[model samples]
Target: MRFAHLRVEGQTTPRLAVVEGESAIFLDEVMRRAPRDLQDLIEQGPEGLARVRSAVGAAEPGTSVGAAEPARGAVDPVASDPAAPGTLPRHPVADLRHSSAVLRPAQVIAIGANYAAHASELKLRSETAMTIFSLWPNSLTAHGATTTWPEDLTTQVDYEAELGVIIGRPARGVHARDALDYVWGYTVVNDITARDIQFSEAQWSRCKSFDGFTPTGPVVVTADEIPDPQELWLTTNLDGSIMQDASTSEMVRSVAEIISLLSRSATIPPGTLISTGSPGGAGYSRKPPVFLRDGSTVTVSIGGIGSLTTHCRVI
Candidate 1:
C-alpha cells in the first residue's frame, strides 16, 4: 500500500492517508483509533499495518457497518457512507498540498558517491567504506513545493536524484542479509545541493542540508510492493531535458549494505530517512553547466515509486 501526508487547500495541518488509485483515503476516517502519522503506524509493526489495510479495504467498498468519523484532528471525508464514491472526500491531486511523506524522522542520513559512475565523475573514492552523511531536518520538503536559495549563496545548484528508504524498526549491527528487514517503505528523493558550499566544506552535511534542499515523496510505497530495491530505475529531468538516467543496480554499495554498515555503529531509529546516492550526469559535470534558475522545475522519478517535482526559486 502507498501512503502520504497530505492536506487540502487552506488546511494548515497534514494527515496520514492511504493513496488508492487517484483518490486518497484518510486512515483516521476508517480506523477507530488511527495511528497519528506514518511514524506512529510504522512503529506499531506489521499487525498495525494489517489493521490499516483491512480498514482501507472495507472503506473502499463503502460499507456502513464499520464506517467511522475521522479522528478529532483528521481530515474530514466528504461523507461517512462507505459504499458511495460521492461520499469519499477527494481533492484533485494537483490541487492538494503535500508534506514530506515521513514527517518527524529522527534524522536524514544520505549516502554519497555510492554509485560508481557518480563517484568517478565527481572524482570521489567509491572503493573505500561507504560515504555516509547526515542532512538536517530543515532540508526536508514535500513534492510540488518550491525550493529557494539566495543567488549569492551559490550559482551552481545541482540536483542529485536518489531513492529514499524509511526505516521501520530500530536497527543495530544488522547484517547485510537482514538489513532490508528493518525498512518500512521507499520514496523518491531529490538531494539538491549547493556546489560551491560542498567543495569548500570539509563535512558534506551542512552544504546539502539547506532548508528545502531535500524534496521527498509524492508517496511512499510499502516494502512488500518492491521486492528488490536494487532493481529499480531512476531519472532526473530538469525542465524538459533528461539529464541523469541510471538504475539502483549501478550502486557501488547496495541499500542493504549501507543500512548494515550504519547499524554497526549507531542504532538507526525508526522513521529515519536514508537517501541512497544519485547516479552520474550532475549538471556540474555537463559540458555547459545547467544549474537551476528561478522558475526551473525539476522532477525525479523511481521505477514503481512515483515522480517528485520541485519548483525552483532564487531569492
Candidate 2:
C-alpha cells in the first residue's frame, strides 16, 4: 500500500491519504479517528495498518484485494470527501499540495558515503566508519515545493538522490539479516547540499539543513511492496541534464546493514527517516562542476517509490 500527506492548496493542514495511481482515498474521510499522519499510523503498529486496509477495502472498484499495486506514482496531491463511511471518495492527486512525506518523524538521520562510487567521486574514504548526520526538521519540505537558499551562502548547490527508510518500530541490537523487519516503508529523498558550506564545515547538518534542503516524497510505499531495497535504481535530473545515476545495489553498505549498525548503540524509534546515502555522479564532482542556480528544477527518483521534484530559487 502507498501513503502520503496531502492537502488542498489553500488548506492549512495536510490529510493522510491512501494513494492510488492518480487519485487518493483519504483515511480521515473513510475511517473514524483515522491515523493523523504516516508517523501516527506507523506508531499504531501493524494493527493500525490492517485497520486502514480494511477501511479502504475495494475503494478502487476494479482492483482485486491483495493485488499487485504500483509502488507509487507522481502525486502532486489533492483531496475530496465521501458522504458516508465504508464508501471512499477518490480525490485527484494532481490537484493537492504536499507536506513532508514523514511529518513529525522521531528524527531524521542521514548516512553519508554509503555508496562507494559516490565516496570515490567525492574523495571521501568509505573504508572507515559510517558517516551519519542529522537533518533539522526545518529542512523537511514537500514535493513540488520551492527551496530558496541565500545567494551569498552557496553557489555550488548540488543534489543527491537517495532512498529513504522509515523505521516501523524501536530497534536495538538487531542483526542485518533481520533488520528489514523493522522497516515500515520507503520514500524518495533529495539531499540537497551546499558544496561550499559542506567543504568548509566540520559537521554536515548545518550546511544541508537550510530550510527546504531535504524535500521528500510524493508518497511512501510499504516495505512489503518493495521485495528487495538493494535492487532499486536512483537518479538525479538537475534542470534537464542527468547528473547522478546509479543503482542502490552499488552502496558500500546495504540498507539492512545501515539499520543494523545504527541500532547497535542508539534505539531507532518508529518513523525515523534514514536517508541511506547517494550513488555516484554528484555535480560537484563533474568535470565542469554543475550547480543549482536560480530557477533550477531538480527531480530525484527511486524506481517503484516515485519521484520528488523541487524548485530552486536564490534569495
Backbone clashes for every candidate come to 2, 2
Candidate 2 per-residue C-alpha lDDT over 52-72 given as tens digits, one digit per residue, 9 for 90 to 100: 887676465543222123223
* Model 1: worst 10 consecutive residues (lDDT sum): 61-70
lDDT of each candidate versus the true structure: 0.85, 0.87
Question: How many pairs in model 2 have backbone atoms within 3 A of each other, for residues 3 or more apart or on separate chains, i.e. clashes?
Answer: 2
lDDT, candidate 1, 93-195, per-residue tens: 5556799887888788999999988888888999988888899999999999999999987888999999999999999999999999999999999999998
Global Cα lDDT for candidate 2? 0.87
Q: Which candidate is the best by lDDT?
A: 2
Off by over 4 Å in 1: 61-91
TM-score of 2: 0.92
TM-score of every candidate relative to the true structure:
0.91, 0.92
